[model samples]
Target chain A: DVKVTQSSRYLVKRTGEKVFLECVQDMDHENMFWYRQDPGLGLRLIYFSYDVKMKEKGDIPEGYSVSREKKERFSLILESASTNQTSMYLCASSSTGRNQPQHFGDGTRLSIL
Target chain B: AQRVTQPEKLLSVFKGAPVELKCNYSYSGSPELFWYVQYSRQRLQLLLRHISRESIKGFTADLNKGETSFHLKKPFAQEEDSAMYYCALSGQSDSWGKLQFGAGTQVVVTP
Candidate 1:
């Protein structure tokens, strides 16, 4: 079974602070994604990396950035955190197939003060 | 624009009762849909995919293009069936498996 590990289960940061959320997948999958899960809005994609050094902005990429220096690790970066950015963040990884199912990590619940 | 929609935010049902979670999507090209479940304190996992056409854990969903709906159904609900359900569409607009997810529905099964 594939395992996706998130660095944190709970995170707290102050407004205007920079934040980093790390995710690692053991299956050597080529695709990685970052999403913010909100109650009414559901999970909205922030950024995704299909390969090392390649990234694409998803629907809700504002206030967020990503890094994929290696295949197994993907990191989401908040250049300047705000209170509105507090939400549950999820990381997912998948193989290179249209029909492949995404494997998700236990999310990090972030609270920005 | 490609999008997925799960209309209900919460669904409460009794054990042994029939349960259905509605999911609808809007996409321009060929569509592939999937249902995901997240149990309490557990990571989200794939429950079933429409392309696979296989029932998982007694839950089955059929894609209806005319209705643009992929409603998940179970004949007899179990106590363990309670969870957060999400409907997702694989994005064809971009190459990689970027998914468009819907606002999830929370199912609660009571005795």
Candidate 2:
């Protein structure tokens, strides 16, 4: 079965601290995405990489950055964490084909204090 | 702009009752619609896609292009069926990924 895994299931960070959320996929999918899930807001895409070293900004990319040094891993970076940034972060990956379903990780519930 | 909307925030029903989750989209071209479910403590997963036209877990959805709506329906609700459901659409552009999700609906099933 295809699987996506996150580095942390829960995380707490202080304000102004830099944070990193790591994601890895075992399916060798070419597309990976980072999204923040919140009540009422649903899942808003933050950043996505279609290929290694290639990245595109989603609808809500402010206060976030991403890096894809390897094909299997994608990292979401918060330059300066804030209380408002606290939410459930999800990582997903899919194959190169269009309209294919994305496989998601369990998610990391990040809290910025 | 392409968008998807799931107006209801919550739906409550008794076990064995029918359930319907509505989804509407605003897109000019042919749209690819999908329904995703997230069970308690589980990751969000695809329930079904309009293109596949297959039933999953006794649930099915039909895309009504004239209404621009794709609603999910199940004849009977199970206690385990309670979860958050999201409707999504794909962007027609050249972008590699195709997921523009709705606000989501939380279904609560009673005994």
Candidate 3:
């Protein structure tokens, strides 16, 4: 079974605080992604990394950044948390091949107070 | 721009009754469509993909290119089938790593 692990399932942070959400996959997948899931907005991609030290911005990447220092790990960083950023964050990974299904980890629900 | 739309926010059905969840997409290329399900307290997982053309748990989805839709259907709904269903499309040119998802539809199966 493929396993994708998230560092935290639930988190609360104060406004203007810096936050980190970590994700790791054991499948040696070359593709990793960060998305924020909201009530009516659905899942919006924040950022993604196709290789270590390489990252690309997604549709809603204005408030988020990502780091892929290692092949198996990808991290999402919130430079300054805000109330509007409170939402469920999901981490996903897929192989290098095109049209491959993405495997998701248990989401991390973040709340910014 | 590639996009997916799930028309219904909620759908209810009785056990053994037929169920259908509508999904539509807008893309110029040959899109690969998929249905993903997330059960309560469970992670989101793939239920079926259009490319496979196979039924999963008696649920099937057919891609109608003419209509730009890929709707999920089940002949009989079961209690265990109740879950949040998301319609997704693969946009390889944009980013092979991520999947664009719909707002999702909540299915409730009554006994």
Candidate 4:
């Protein structure tokens, strides 16, 4: 089974503070994704990394960025945390295959004060 | 651009009753649809996919290309069936392993 682990389950930060959310996958998957899940909006992709040192912008990438220095780890960075940026952050990983399912972490509920 | 839509925000059903969760999508190319379930305190996981045509935990979804819908159906609901269900659409031609997710439907199965 694929295990996707998020570094934190809950987080609190003040506005304008720099925030980092870490994710690690043990399955050696080639794809990693970061998403912000909100009520009534479901899950919106923030950033995705297909390989080490490579990243792509997702649907909502204005305030967020991602880094994949290592293949098994992907980190999401909030340049300046804001109240609107607070949400449940989810990390997912999937192996390269046809119709492969992405394994998700438990998620991190972030609160920006 | 592709979009996934789940019309119902919440669905309530009694144990042993049938349940159906509707999902619709607007995509130009060939679409791959999937159902994901997030139980309380658990991570979101794939329940079933249209390509698999297989049932999981007594839940099944059929893709209707003509109607652009993939609705999940369960013949008998159980208390454990209560969860947040999300319908997703994958764009095979445009991207890899990226999915468009619906807002999700919260299902409550009471005894």
Candidate 5:
């Protein structure tokens, strides 16, 4: 069984504040992803890291960034959190192969006030 | 552009009735389709994939390239089978790590 752990299950932050969402995977997968799940919009990718120090922007990369200093950990950073930034953030990891299923964390419900 | 479309937002059926969730995709290259399910208060997990061609939890999905659709079906719906189902397509060949997901369908099984 694979374990993907998010730093927080529920988070609250004020507007204009910096926020960090951490994720760690025990599977040591080579690919890590950050996505925001919204109603009627599905899961939109924000950022993804293929390897340590390598990052790529996804569909909804604006207002967010990512860090992958190590193979097991990936972090999402919100530079200046706003009310609109509130969302359920999900972290997922997958092996370095084609059609590999992504393992997801429990997700963090973020609230920006 | 690659896109995944799950037209149905909600589906309700009796516990013993059959259920189906529709999914479609638009991509120029070969597509790898997948179905993911998220139970109440649980994380999302893979239900099945087109490439694997394996039925899981009594659920099966067939990839119809002619229709560009991959619809999930189950003969007998169970209360525990109720969950959010999402259809996803792998990104371009060069970017297989990325996936485009559908809006998802919430299934409700009534006793």
Candidate 6:
């Protein structure tokens, strides 16, 4: 079974603070993604990395950046968090194949005060 | 722009009743569709994909290209089947790893 582990199940951060959400996958997938899940908005992509040091902006990449220094780990960074940034963050990984289904982590519920 | 639309936010049914969750998509080219389920306190998992044409957990979905819909259906609803279902689409020209998802439907099966 594939395992996608998130560093935090719940997180709290203050406004204007830097925040990091980490995700690690054991399946050695080549594609990793960061998404924010919101009510009525579904899961909107924030950023994705196809390979180490290669990143692309998704539909909602503003105020967020991602790091993929290694194949197994992907990190989402919020340089300065705000209350609007509070949402359930999910990390997913998939093989390079076109039709491969993504495996998702348990998600981190972020709260910005 | 590609988009996935799941119109229902919540659906309730009896344990033995049939269930259906509707999903529609707007894409210019051929796209891959998927149904994902998230059980309470569990990670989101893939239920099925259109390309596979296989039924999972007693549920099946058929892709209708004319209508651009992929509605999930089950003959008998079970309490254990209650979960949040999300419809997702891929296969955009430039975005391979990106999936556009719908708002999701919360299914509640009453006993």
Give the true-contact fraction for every prediction, in order. 0.71, 0.51, 0.58, 0.58, 0.59, 0.58
- Candidate 3 local lDDT, A1-113, one digit each (tens): 88999999999999999999999999999999998988877888899899999998988998788899999999999999999999999999999755678899999999999
DockQ pick, better of 1 and 4: 1
Interface RMSD of 5: 1.5
Lowest summed lDDT across 10 adjacent residues in model 3 chain B is found at: B91-100
Steric clash pairs (candidate 4): none
Rank candidates by DockQ, best first: 1, 4, 5, 2, 6, 3
In model 2, residue pairs whose N, Cα or C atoms come closer than 3 Å (at least 3 residues apart or on different chains), thus clashing, are none
DockQ, per model, reads 0.78, 0.68, 0.65, 0.70, 0.69, 0.67
Worst 10 residues of 3 chain A by lDDT: A93-102
Candidate with the larger DockQ of 1 and 2: 1
Q: How many backbone clashes does candidate 3 have?
A: 0
Candidate 1 has a TM-score of: 0.98
lDDT (Cα atoms) of all candidates against the true structure: 0.94, 0.94, 0.91, 0.93, 0.94, 0.94
Q: Assess candidate 5 and give its TM-score to the true structure.
A: 0.98
Enumerate residue pairs that collide in model 6. Answer: none
CAPRI class of candidate 3: medium
Error of 4 at B38 (Å): 0.3
Model 3, B50: alpha-carbon shift in Å? Answer: 0.7
True contacts kept of 5: 0.59
Clashing pairs in 1: none
Query: Across residues A8-104, which tens digit of lDDT does each residue of candidate 6 receive?
Result: 9999999999999999999989999999999888899999999999999999999999999999999999999999999999999998765789999
- lDDT of candidate 4 at residue A57, scale 0 to 100: 94
- Which parts of model 4 are misplaced by more than 4 Å? none
Model 1 docking grade: medium
TM-score of each: 0.98, 0.98, 0.97, 0.98, 0.98, 0.98
The TM-score of chain B in candidate 5 is 0.96
List the pairs of residues colliding in candidate 3.
Answer: none
Report the lDDT tens digits of candidate 2 across residue range B5-71: 9999999999999999999999998888889999999999999998899999999999999999999
TM-score of model 4 vs. true structure: 0.98
> Against the true structure, what is model 5's DockQ?
0.69
Candidate 4, residues A20-106, lDDT tens digits: the string is 999999999999999999989999999988899999999999988889999999999999999999899999999875499989999
- Estimate candidate 6's RMSD in Å: 0.9
Chain B vs. true chain B: TM-score for each candidate? 0.97, 0.96, 0.95, 0.97, 0.96, 0.96
